[model samples]
Target: MKFNRQKREEIITSKKKETWGQEIKRNWQLYLMLALPFIYIVVFKYYPMVGAQIAFRKYVPAFGIWGSKWVGLYQFERMFSHPIFWKALKNTITLSTYTLLLSIPIPIVLAICFEYARGKFFRKSVQMSAFLPHFLSTVILVSLINLLFDNRTGVFIHIIQNIFGAKVNVLGDAKFFRHLYVWSGIWQGAGWSSILYISALSGVDTQIHEAAIIDGANKWRRIWHIDLPSIRPTIAIMTIMSMGSILSVGFDKTYMMQNPINYDYSEVLATLEFSMGTAGSVPDYSFAAAIGLAVSVVSFVMVMITNKISKTLSDNSLW
Candidate 1:
């Protein structure tokens, strides 16, 4: 009788909801695991935001960040009025849009291909080959591009001359800048990018695919109806991420690939930021900071807008 009473009380206690603090205490190990990331974010991400004030201040190195004169939006006004700024902005948008447009679908298709591929060894070898290029540094990749596309001794140059009856400066030509940039990026990143989709696809229930098979669904129909819907949320998330970075292209490869002839087409916000920030004897740190801040603001706004649209159109969103 006493044991029965104790069992009843234990059952009641187990049914009771945990308070926030109590739950944290119970899952302290998980919370402990999160502490490092929380600290890192606060230190590296949030802390530097204080220095973003340099964008508004005429940041004289002699006077330091805070001691410098606060000129409000003068830096932004200067940036906006510059023709080079406009050119850089246009190039940045064009390159990023091309990248984003191709980045999304290619990865999804590649991941699906990897999933449906037969023969374990063949799939692994192909995936490894595709992913290997991702580890190459930007400088090395640029060097390889030079070697393969150089106007004089490049292998492709001979083919181009043979086919077109004229020598084309593939490396130095302004017209080829965007093509080389976007396509090389696709080749380098497509496999690495597909990893997330592959992970999401792997988690999909096999029973669902089997059931579809039983219902007379061909591979195409099954992929269209089953695999796609299962991974729709992942696709939505990737789309939002790509839209968020629509203005922020990387610096190293673009800078390395850029030469005098292609500067007009290749100049982007990051390269512009570098040139503005370190422009010889009298570097305009304030203007550079302003440009950086502007890019970050635009990126953030893109993420928010994309997230809202995603939420409205579908059930998946970052929030």
Candidate 2:
């Protein structure tokens, strides 16, 4: 009986190995193409996971990552006690929430408009104009923003001042920072973001539209009943993904747009990490790492929660 079982196991193992060999042999070129990306993820993404250990250590430059003394959660304790960390965390969440709330619907609306528009030429023109700004680098975008809102030279500032005989510094005012950041990002990314929805809309069954038309459904009714239902899954998925990053605001744009006057409202976690780790006289590498780790943990938890909620409510989730 033992010999019979062993023989059966051997046959199964041999078959599995043979199947793997056949797969590799048949798709050797495809495996070769995958090699670079595999190496890239190993080198760039997974490898850096080892360095995350610094968050739990006293990361002295002399001691190095591995050689650094283990400090448990000392850095995290310091971060929790730091006023700037809380401020930065608060600002980061606030900005991200505002951007998410304000920017999420614009792309959907624009994509729907594009799908429903009668004039192909006008749609293309509008799409090109909306997409053009996304290509601008963060530096150039910030510079353009400054030029457009500068207290003295900004066209909008000039017009407002001329019309109302009042001075306004939109960039300098902390009250306006969130609005500027969110709206500028909307302007830059709305068209690009809508492309996915547009593609989804295009794939909608033409037969459904034809049936709706035959049933005396107007364009608005078709959009309401047919178009939106078709893209509801996409919308739910996009929104779930967005909710996952409720703490991550891009550093470059925030940093470039940030000034002393707006720091109270604009100093997000990413910029704070940059400032804490590199900008000071004595860099607090461990503390910065702890903050980064905290942010990552929070983001992961949020993603999980968002995915769970989405799955429960809509049966659509990243997982």
Best by TM-score: 2
Model 2: residue 187 alpha-carbon error in angstroms = 0.9
Clashes of 2: 0
Residues 1-319, model 2: lDDT tens digits = 9999999999889777677778788789999999999999999988777788899999888888999999999999999899898899899989898889876888899999998878989989988998898898999888988899998889999898989899788877889988889888988888899998999999999999999999999999998999999998899889888886788899999999998899899899999888889976779898888888888888889888888988999898886
* Every candidate's CA RMSD: 4.0, 6.0
Off by over 4 Å in 1: 1-40, 162-166
Model 1 lDDT tens row, 103-175: 9999999999999999999999999998999999999888988998988889899999999999998887789
Lowest-sum lDDT 10-residue window in model 2: 14-23
lDDT of 1 at 3: 100
The ten-residue window of minimal lDDT in model 1 covers: 11-20
Candidate 1, after superposition: displacement of residue 200 in Å?
1.5
